[model samples]
Target chain A: MGNSFFTPLSWNDTGFILTGVLNTVTISLVAIIVGTLLGLAVGFIRAEANRFTNILLGGVLDALRSVPLIIQLILFSTYVGAIGHPLDPFVTGSIVLSLYSMAFMSEVFRGGFESVHHSMATAARSLGMSYWQTVAYIRLPIGLRAVFPSWLGVALSVIKDSALVSVIGYMELLRTSEQLISRTQQPLEILIGVGLFYFIVSYPLSLYGRYIERKMAI
Target chain B: MEYEFHWIIVFQKLPQLLNGAFVTLHVSVLSMLIGITIAVLLAIMKMSKARIVSLPATLWVEIARNTPALFQIYMAYFGLGAFGIHLSPYAAVLSALVFVNAGYLTETFRGGFQAIPKTQYSASKSLGMNSVQIYRYIILPQMFRRIYHPMTNQFVWSILMSSLGILVGMDELSGETQRLQSLSFRTLEFFIVAAVMYFLITKLVLFSAALIARRVFRGDL
Candidate 1:
């Protein structure tokens, strides 16, 4: 018993944990950026689309949101491999995560675009502004400005959901901590650290969101 | 594109998959019920002026809202196990779902409650209604009306999130699919069925929610 060694987390593991943190942040940032762009484009097109077009598009996007994301990730990862076109875990994870985020982002953006009151657009049109001019001059600015809180909300959720990407073998923070916990046999300390990391990153953003929302309400 | 489809194994596994779906539904409904009860109390506490009362409520909401549900599950499972207080995979996932639902719903309820006018409360008092009568007859109904849509959304979310159970070896729909695929070497077919099952469950829920909303709100919604 005296000669036996207990494996504990050493200082060397700091670098390992940091890599996981960085990977998580990088994947989330990529998905959020790509998703927001696609969402903005799709949402705007949908907002301007006729009823038939809107339904056709909304049905597809709604289906994306209906399924669980973990299932989507696993299916996509395995399906791609099953077919003749296998991809890297990072590549597959980002692609599925981005598409998932886009599904939600498009809804948030659609609501934002629609919140540009009809009367305001009519006023713009009455003043001899073209349709494109009104969209640019009035609708775009007001809608985008008003949706900062919700956009931030989606972005934060994306950050949290990024943890699920680890399932596909992309080593995120949770995945890294799981390894450490298993090696050290100390789950509580490691899990608390992970929770604290997320809380620290997320709490400030949510506070900012609330602050912006309160200011806008006035 | 060269992979051949073999769906026969998936067909034979249908009964097990359905059982998994039932477990998924049962857990999510249980979580939502517990979550709603806690949310209602937390919402009230959040609005209270007492520091001790509001602080813990705020903390719970923030922690639940900010952390990943996956992390919460792990904490309940492995983290608690570290301390000699073990929870089953089902218990861990259920508790995690409830924690998140309550956090999000507290905010939703607060919004609903605040939407009721202050003048209405004073008016109710002048009309000879006590606090209990006022809340039971007036405030509660209006709050529920305002919160109904969001609550349905939360229910759908809980169902979706319960899929996280797969990670913890829980035999919910996703977990069951994982097991079936590993056995039959038919990952795509099994998961595709599971995905469709989830889609159906959520759609059924939304349809029923819509029907109930129409009846309860008398088409106002």
Candidate 2:
């Protein structure tokens, strides 16, 4: 078992696979950074906007949230390509990941904003702070700190979900592992390696999230 | 770019898409039922003081939560085959999802168990109930109530994640969409319709869960 699975593999083959890890990290970094920024903006709008706009945006965001990320990725990839606005798979994957992350992140951010006591906002107003000033100085710092764990959870999910880009033929870690398996016919070893790679990347984030939750509880 | 839109192909293919939706629902509901049963046991095991009892459950939840569901599905479908154990795409998706659903719900349910005051167990024991009776007659009912909403949310998650079955060539919603779009060359319309179908199914599941919760729990929950 060991000889068959382990013999044909060289460091060069492993190096090829590690390149997929680079793409995976790059895509996730872009998605998380852009998604969180957009999410915070949308969340702020949702939390503080007029009633009419809130209802409109809520309906749209909820619709986006309802569908699965894989479906969104496939649909977005195919739809854009068929419409003659052909995009590279990485572009489509990143766009879908960012959009999907934005939906959940917005909800998380909204919850964070809503959890802050209204009295704090009222006090800020009493001090003649402008709405923007109150948001920047009072609500954001407190709400962001409170939602850090939830945000971390979302970020971790984005990293994990980035694996689905392989479905669209984006040559990320999972896809690379799939190719490597076909070449080596050693599915067990290659997949375990892939899974362990993910675990290593994500487990620290999970631990940090638990740490943040513990600190916040105190 | 002037692109022609083909709404008619989507309307014509609605029946196939609906069949795929049923497949998606079947996989999700079955997985959730089995997953919850396993999750309850895992939660109990995790709460045990003995290392032999708790270690495995903790490791399962740790690995399951940190990894991607797609990887789990691939490993089940592809990795198991390496061991000469072949599973059909449907079976692979179901088993993988059951693993993941149980992993997530174990924590949710452990939290539920913790929410039940320790006094309830003592009270039940004082009434001459043994461990099994205390759990069955006292702990479980309240745990179910506490975790009902989150359980429903997980059900929705199961439904959504079943879309991953497409990668394994399972003829679920996304798979059917891919096949039909490639055949008709109506990629845009087919996928747009598929996305709408997914959106509707999820909303329906959420609404139905709410309705059932209202009826079953009545005023208590």
- Clashing residue pairs in candidate 2, if any? none
TM-score attained by model 2: 0.94
Instruction: For residues A96-184, write the lDDT of model 2, one tens digit per residue.
Output: 99988998999999988988889999999999999889899999999999999999999999999999988888999999988888777
DockQ, structure candidate 2: 0.75
Model 1 TM-score?
0.97
Return the top candidate by TM-score.
1
lDDT tens per residue, model 1, A48-131: 899999999999898889999999999999999999798988899999999999988888888889999999999999999999
Residue A192 accuracy (lDDT) in model 1: 96
Best by DockQ: 1
Which lDDT tens digits does candidate 2 get at residues B1-221? 67788799889989999999999999999999999999989998999999999999999999999999999999999999988999999999999999999999999999998988999988998999999999897888888888998888888889889999888899999888888888988877887888888899989988998888888779677
Total clashes for model 1? 1
- Give the poorly placed runs of model 1, Cα more than 4 Å off: A1-6, A125-130
